[model samples]
Target: MTAAEPNRGLIHFSPRSGWMNDPNGLLHYRGTYHFYFQHAPGSLVWDTMHWGHATSPDLVRWTEQPIALDPAIHPGDLWSGGGVVDLRNTSGLKSGDHDPIVVFSGTQGVRMFYSLDGGFTFTPYDGGRVIAQPSGRESRDPKVVWHEPTGQWAMVVWSDADGNGVDFFVSPDLLQWERTSRYAAGWFFECPDFTPMDLDGETVWVLRDARGSYVVGAFDGRTFTTAWTSPQTITTNPGAAGSDYYAAQSFDNVDRTVTMAWQGGNHGATWTGNASFPVEQELVGTPDGPRVLSRPVDEIRTLRHDTQSWPEATFSAGTHVLGEGCTAELEIAGASRACTLRIRGCFDVPVAPDETLRLLVDRGQLAVFSGLDYRCLNVDLDRRAAGDEIALVTDGPLRVSSLVLHQLRP
Candidate 1:
């Protein structure tokens, strides 16, 4: 079954046609941010993969650009990888002062592509394939980042082939990579990303897996030591169990760590998959342990159309209408009991203590994000629930410190 019309998203990014998954080559180049994804252009279901491109001046508003890389340029279907701005002509791929954008993906081996035109288009470098395929197991998804201390480029690729967590490789010129270190901990699989973020005014590195689970630790260019591990299922809400946020990646060249993911809502659409709204990633020290906290970018407020405000309201254990099916932000300081926020019976968001939650409702889909742990839930409904009415029900005492709802514009 295929959707008759393409489902449009207000803040999330979705292609106009075909299938998309695993945000790839997220880069902040020049003055604009580029978003590339694993896309199959002709069909809704996953097929031959190509790199789909989109750009945004700010993280909130995105405009779809032309396809960046296609399978015809490589030996195999274009898989997951990353992009980097070859500043200082490190890779010697830069033709002019624009500092060419270099992208890496795994087809037969680690393939390299460079764009001289500011990431608008790309061409195969060195006959397309660079590093040969790793022996034994098939590994893809190379996440490249600049290692400042070592003054070189570093990449982390994951494969479950040989009791390994992630393989770390270092390249001096962005073309030749040498294996430096290997990390094996927990159940790590595909789409490896390593980023450094500030924790309590201290800088720490975070290693993220394809499952959306991440390990906070320290990386000295090559080796990584895990300080804390947070599973993707850290959501305290039962309703959030349905969220499928996978293959999330972060971009470089930004002041703060910004991460996005494929929402993984493949509910029989003619064109499926969408990017989760960009979140500001930071480390939060909890009583239990050190964990990562993500908050929606403030630019999201720019999409707010109509507005409704309620300050410190008390509700019983039943359905309480808040507002309409739009974007809503709620702050819960102290809730004596557990509660679920719903809209037309489509969204069921569990409220946590002293946390901010953002809910976006567009047509038949509901996306909820918790600011406390960065837990997000995206669910597609069978029927369109229309109206400007939201329901909040709880079994025990429910007291909200603040509640604000806004209608989102296209």
Candidate 2:
């Protein structure tokens, strides 16, 4: 299939004109996936933020839509938040029988916007009135989810009284809300999401941390109690260990629950760009606990140009070259001392004599070094070996396979 095929590999959606960040207002309504984000049409800065909208039937192919929420519509700028479909049409009835309600956060307060003629055009409800705002605290990044058990709506807002964290509120009707509790201090928790996941026939709440990492816990609508001692780090591209990945969130559509992140330069950096790709997230069991593993979605099979496989090969302290768009595998043995096998280079860095053999890959350079404590080889030269193996993508060109020199200990 061609690159522009409908079912192409991991696809990405950014503003057609400018800077985009933080996937916001993710909703699946009327058999379509709709999402919005913080977009600045002119510059790369975050000052002038607007809601950029896009829709997709399948998660792989996205169709861009017009600006959903403009800053000019409201007095102040648009901020990060989420959207939900009002299946019941609780707001009011329109000519089409029902409308989609979008709850978003802005500079002044949390406001609701609705679309009568489908999700194409949206206007503020109740004369664009502000619903809720803290007295002394500034609240933004509102993530709303409907609680099925209590039959109530819950929202988590990014606020600061002691420090930057999330505050919880409950609403019987979407309009009026009551403050219930607060999730104590942490780093700037921008996009907080609470969803129920099935694990071993038990339900667990997944909380997404925008700035740092995501947490899996048990939540009872009013309060969230963390079940895990530590939070899991969410990265954009699990295939490569680059520093340009950050700020990912989950999109729970009808078909699947996938996650996406902003793939670009780091914050306060000048070299930021766009995403390499978007992958599907799956929950798998590990020895430690349940972890998230990202892989190119099944649609990616259409993007395969050609497939090449290397059966069995052994190399020792030598340099080899290969053409582009190729996959190669190597198995080494009989090295008494830890040694390095450099690909596309001639230098063989010494691996510690006692450590296990290591595999490293730079941009296009690939190598294998020995030793567990090979600090230089593991840290500086081979940056891919820093994280857990299951979380890493092994099918791509950046995959590194390692082998120990000695025989099995059994």
**What tens digits encode model 1's per-residue C-alpha lDDT throughout 1-410?**
22234345655778878888889999897779899999898987778898999999988778888888987755555899888887778987767658888888984357788889899878887777557344326677888999888899988877655665777888889888888778876567678888888887877888877766667788888788875543443233322111357787898788888888876664344577788778777778878667777677777778777787767878777787876654445444555566777776655678766666666665444555665545555555435454546777887667877777777765
Using TM-score as the measure, the top candidate is 1
> For candidate 2, lDDT tens digit of each residue in 1-410?
12222211123444555667767777776667676777776776665888777787755467778888887885344777777776765544455654565656665477777777556677876777777674336777777877767887788777776876677888876778787887765544566766667667776766766642566677777887776655666542222222344455556434455555554442212212233244455455678687655544455344344333322333433333322211122233333444444332323444333333433222222223232111111112122222211111111122223332211100
Reference-based TM-score, model 2: 0.69
Each model's C-alpha lDDT?
Answer: 0.73, 0.53
TM-score of each: 0.88, 0.69
